[model samples]
Target chain A: MLNPGSLTVIGLGPGSPAQRTPEVEAALAEATDLVGYAPYVARVPHRPGLYRHASDNRVELDRARHALQLAEAGARVAVVSGGDAGVFAMASAVFEALEAGDPAWRALDIRVLPGISAMFAAAARIGAPLGHDFCAISLSDNLKPWEVIQHRLLAAALGGFVMALYNPLSRARPWQLGAAFTLLRQHLPGTVPVIFATAVTRPDERITVTTLAEADPALADMRTLVMVGTAATRLLPRPGGAAPWVYSPRSVPAS
Target chain B: MLNPGSLTVIGLGPGSPAQRTPEVEAALAEATDLVGYAPYVARVPHRPGLYRHASDNRVELDRARHALQLAEAGARVAVVSGGDAGVFAMASAVFEALEAGDPAWRALDIRVLPGISAMFAAAARIGAPLGHDFCAISLSDNLKPWEVIQHRLLAAALGGFVMALYNPLSRARPWQLGAAFTLLRQHLPGTVPVIFATAVTRPDERITVTTLAEADPALADMRTLVMVGTAATRLLPRPGGAAPWVYSPRSVPAS
Candidate 1:
């Protein structure tokens, strides 16, 4: 039997329409309904005859359930996210809702499209800060206890991995990044490069390369993504006339 | 005075026409001339009335020089790369050539449009294997010394950074990946999650998640992009009716 109901989770790729892949556009064009966080839905340019279901960010499960319900009713649906659907985004919620709901949803076809993540965009703009192995951890501790985050942070720092700090801090979680910094300092050297990339791939983008010791807690916010490079992550001048790029030096050249 | 000649570097995003972003499409549509590595140029569907220049892979300088010539003649030119232009791709070459060329060529406006990097595409298929910090390195060392690559590898391994290995191995460079793995094993634990992602964003796409020690060097080629995750990377089985996903557990929940 033809699969009448299906879901396509599309990554918007940073925030630009130019960055949206053709596959994502086609999926959006073919979709009868769009479900996502309210702000994400607003980003799509005006399109008539499209049904939209938008919810606030906190109720991800609700949003996923709604999308599945629409799909179940034979609507072609697209669940959208800003960066990538699978990277700390809506794909998990969709899966969670599916697992928690009727087994019949298993028969529905689903596809996930990749988008440019903020860390990669940030790295691209500031050279190859992520040229070495690294890890990303959110400073916020709503679902997970802060202790769990500390354990990961200590492990990442001791391992000498570069780090991407998502949700570094917010008004309510003002000291979260500060606390993380303290733990990081215990393991990483003081001179490690820390890149603060804010609003990457957007018009108001700001990038700063500093040392781990000098990364001020005041500079970060919810929108900021912090990339702390390993010992090898260095700031190199744009070679003569090239745009400045951060490259992870190779360990060994091909013989 | 208006910059009559402009340079645009576009990313094709995993070789699929469907995955090509609108911005990239518009750039290609607007360009009077196109320049890129031979295979990358051939991947684009044929379009009439446009000048196309393809060069051997190793001769990046020559490709940049050709693109500059077109731009100098007041043509809207696009230098294309397979993935994001900034990620170990053509953006650097374009700038390098401009810098090494006459001062007049350096004055032209240049824009880089982001595309879906292969690792991002691969990460999405396997469930956020790159949710943490990561690095991308090319194994080939025609330009740089192998020692330099080895140094970077040691730093990445000691630091616990996730890694994406491009140009892992070819007929001539059969032992490169093996040697690199040997060095990596010196610092990183053998059980670190490793994935071989091939033909990303295409119908024939295949992804296999194994461990660094278990990774089969024979399975890799130029077309394959390999992702090596940190110790934290884990595979989650589909809960009854969901697709299996790989994710780096983040400290914070969606807030």
Candidate 2:
């Protein structure tokens, strides 16, 4: 039997109202409760019937639990995340809570609606830097040990995979991106392009492309998404003195 | 000086009309020419002034060249690709053409619009199997050597990445998925979940969850997007015996 309650985990896309999928918009419109980080919850305009449960950024688990509890109470809850919810976002958190929480939440008509990921938004701003095989790694050591990050970074480099590094650097995690760069340098060439795409599609978006040797972690903040190209990635000058386009060719790069 | 001609490459998202973003829809509606594979081109309804150039799927380069040439001739051309265009799609092919074609082509305006990827759509259908660090690898040997695929697959596995495998299998290349499974078995535990999500969100969509050891290559086709879970991926039974929810937690996995 279906529960009267329903919970939807929706990705708002990378900060643009235009980037949000139609399905996600419909879900948000129909939701009785909006639950997420304060910034993400604020993205959706306030409506009289919709209750917004904006919480601290660090409390994903608690936020997830609250959303589930509301859903069980017969509220149509929408838990929002920026970018695609399936990729390192609220979908995972909601699933984690569902697995460990009351068994009754399972039948609560849970669905995850996807949105354009920040990684893809950043990649699109350049040419297709992720045209070939690629991996995405998080630089924050808050959840995993620093050793694990290093191991994955080195392995991704050795695999010749183009990489999109999320949470590259922050006030508390200032050193991880630099350390990641040093480890990657051992495996990749100096000429490989490293792109720091900040606040993609938003008014303050800035995209900087430099070689691996010249890459400085100082350019990145918590809002930035860093992309390290494979050896095959190329940079071409624009005909009108615009920023050069960067992309990895579709064919195989030497491994 | 900016050329009057413009070219835009757009992602159509996973087969669902509602999944497409408004920006992509606007691009498609304003397009003078739509260039892409036949199926993707057919997705858009016929309009009075829109000319469609549906071509063979294998001729990505020639189609890309045709689109660029049209754009140079002052046509507002849109090149469409199913799923995210930057992910092993038309965006890279267009760049490759631009690099090798007439230098004057560089003057043409080009933009890539992000779309929801089939990988993300597939991940949402199941729970968030890609919640943690992950990689996307195409299984087709058409663009790269089987050896290179093996090397990278091993690297991603060693890095403990949940993998989203695109173009997983086809009659043209029958053994790659099986070979990949055999190679991955050397490093990952058999208990790791393997999700085969086919033609996601389409009328004929199918999703099967199996363990690494029990995964069958026959379950996939060219339309399939396969996901392999990491050690941290978990599965939980529904209260009403619906399909179990599967996800990788946000916290660190034992690496």
Candidate 3:
């Protein structure tokens, strides 16, 4: 008899209940096992039937394999990711495991649910720095090399593409973000706006919109989503001394 | 007397109610007037005391101005977009209008509520095409020139970005997507996967996953979100002939 086991990879959407979709909420409610990075898994409240398995951030593949194992054992598992799981998140790791694992796992029901990405969440908090063409690069050299990051940063800068930098800085690799900024400045003007949004949509949310010239790398941490504006990006001054609205206009100037 | 009016730009995620966030649902329930392009505005169910103002897609700035004007007159206005408003949607246009319009509009209660983007929705429908480094580019030449789109596309392709392309083609610009595929072929391997997800997450949704060599531009329309994979992208076959799982692994091999 085939076990009625299934795995759902769901995104919680940047630490806010409001940001999560009705689909993910339903998945979370029906799940027998919850697995994810420690902080993200802890975000989901404990219920008697839901067994939570929280792991450290570095062990994404191991966590994914464990979740798959639980599902294979006839448990309805929900592997959670903070933002959209598809974007440099658990969805990738799950698929990687599914490929390298047992062929029977392929027959198991699996689905990926999208969520509000931290980059888009941060962009929403600011006026829409990603209003135009933008690229999202992970600044963590853990996965790729520092050289790849530098090359992509320079290419994005030269192409006049606005950028969203994820995993901008952490204890393991602190200098990568600063070095990226330095390389970007070589191609982009100093006046370009760089926004650092930490713990976006959470209570400790701090949004600092500064220019490339004065931007401090120390302002960002692992929770931060950094956005670099294109030359066409405008910072509209708000009355009553509120935070200025920054947006990239839909139209680019005729070349 | 202060007007209790407010303006909220909300995204109706990819034509699916399940994909929409709870925050957007609350905003919709509270809104007195809904303003957006005709198709998106039509998505909202009509109720007593709620008014809908739908217009053509070409007049985003004008529609934004109208929404602002409604909010100025004490209307609880919801300007809706199909995907995340911050991503090539009404938010940028609204901010553009806010910057150019009267100063008092800034003082008005204007906020951007994030929603699930079409790109992510499409990515989830497949496996995780955007699992690694990614960029989102709009191929519509209505706002920007074709040359700029070409430049950004080339840059993203060269930088090893798994790209989520919006507005891949329409009647006005038929050849842009084909030319893009050609440009990509020059830099990327012909075996790279290109996915066209049309009307993603909706009743009429259609997905076509093919390689760069076999990709047909005719498969896409304005309602489609196209994904072009990088060299690192993989397509894992499944048991019993299900659609192949496509994803980019989190780690890149050392250069």
Candidate 4:
């Protein structure tokens, strides 16, 4: 009768260490404790029998109850989360702080592993801008009630979908992405294709290709991400002499 | 002065062979020739002095001139592309057949390596449905003009974004995703969310989660992948002993 200390979580993708994943580097070299939030534990890469906790991004239920009290004291923890720890990070505050505290973390052994978010590394460095049907929002309201995120930004802009705009503008919420771009200009159609990637696969990244009325939420911060296409996200012209990317068409061949 | 003979696109993520990367398995163990387009070269795993080729996906300029004629006969080519090889794959038909053919692939050495796309394995099995600012389109138009993808889906649903739909419906275009979901419900908000997912990270994957007026498009095909969540994509309640997942609220906790 001895099996109760697991929990993995992982994801660290879009910030790279060769885009982690050898099963999240063997669950961070077989963890033994690691939690996160302190700059995602300073982007893991230094090991000395591990054991680090670090927190600072709004306590996520006290970092999911200190990684379930170090997996209820059996160790092997882990919890990182930079991109894919089930998307919006911290695996739902470790499953809502293990269901608001113990049921014995239901006998531990949880797992998640899968990263590369940041809008799929800004839709792979601006191209295929997500290739059709899309949605993702977080204009920051401080916990639901900016009239329910402006009624989900007027219902994902009347649903002609294709969006991904995380914590859009930071510095204490710079006018909530300019009031979600004045309610997506009351039903899209301004020339679309607004990319603005930023630090995608690292190495000082920065991509831009505007339109949504010349986007410039003061050149976004919080490590930027904003990709808003659909109208079939185009902007091609790259063949041999690389650079111009974004594509979306999948049919229309016969003139 | 011996440069001209290079093309190395790579990616092969979302199918795990320990999620490749050791610099794409040492550029496919120092390729002698690989070129792709056949279940992505059967997800690469058999080695023995490489040399593959495989094709049959409407030959993008004959797999970009047969990987630049096996890198201009000097071999050492790679190609592949399952995810990050610059998104919609084959590294933009190997740089549009090296900028519309022969200028000596502009002195070779074209690296890419940044895999794991399939919307980051379906946004890591549901949750953080691409935690913010997203766009990715491809309702399958073959090449372009469907009035330029319905004007980029009406500028990504009027720009309150989050999307990632690639080659959405198939079996010869089943009414083009219901005519791009009736032009995104004339601008989104039929309760957004959407999902679909499919073989994300394989193992015969599925993941449904619907909305946008209960998506159908005759139940999407082409190995599905739809996403679409903005205005903070919700659906939480899986905490009871955990393991279901579905989040998107990037920031909100300053009551």
lDDT value, residue B115 of candidate 1: 76
> What TM-score would chain B of candidate 3 score versus the native chain B?
0.98
In the range A1-255, model 4's lDDT, one tens digit per residue, is 655688787888778777676888888998978888887788887788988988887677688788887888888888897766765677766666665577766566676677666776676565455444456666666645576566666655565556677767677777888778777876787787777777777788878777787787787787787877756456755456555666554333445
| lDDT tens per residue, model 3, B1-255 | 777999998988888899899989999999999999999999999999999999997999999999999999999999999999999999999999999998788889888989899999989988999998899999889998889998898899888889998988889889989999999999999999999999988889998889999999999998999999988899988666766889989898796
DockQ of each: 0.27, 0.79, 0.86, 0.14
Which scores higher on lDDT, 1 or 3? 3
Candidate no. 2 TM-score: 0.98
Superposition error at A74 for model 3 (Å): 0.7
Which ranking of candidates, highest lDDT first? 2, 3, 1, 4
lDDT of 1 at B166: 82
Report the number of the highest-TM-score candidate.
Answer: 3
What TM-score does candidate 3 get on C-alpha atoms?
0.99
Candidate 2 residue-wise lDDT, B146-179, digit = tens:
8989999999999989999988878888999999
Interface Cα RMSD of candidate 1: 5.2
Q: What is candidate 1's lDDT per residue for B49-126, written digit by digit as tens?
A: 778888877787788888888888888988888877766677666666665687777567667677788877887677
Ranking by TM-score: 3, 2, 1, 4
Q: Which stretches of candidate 3 lie over 4 Å from their true place?
A: none
> How does candidate 4 fare on TM-score?
0.34
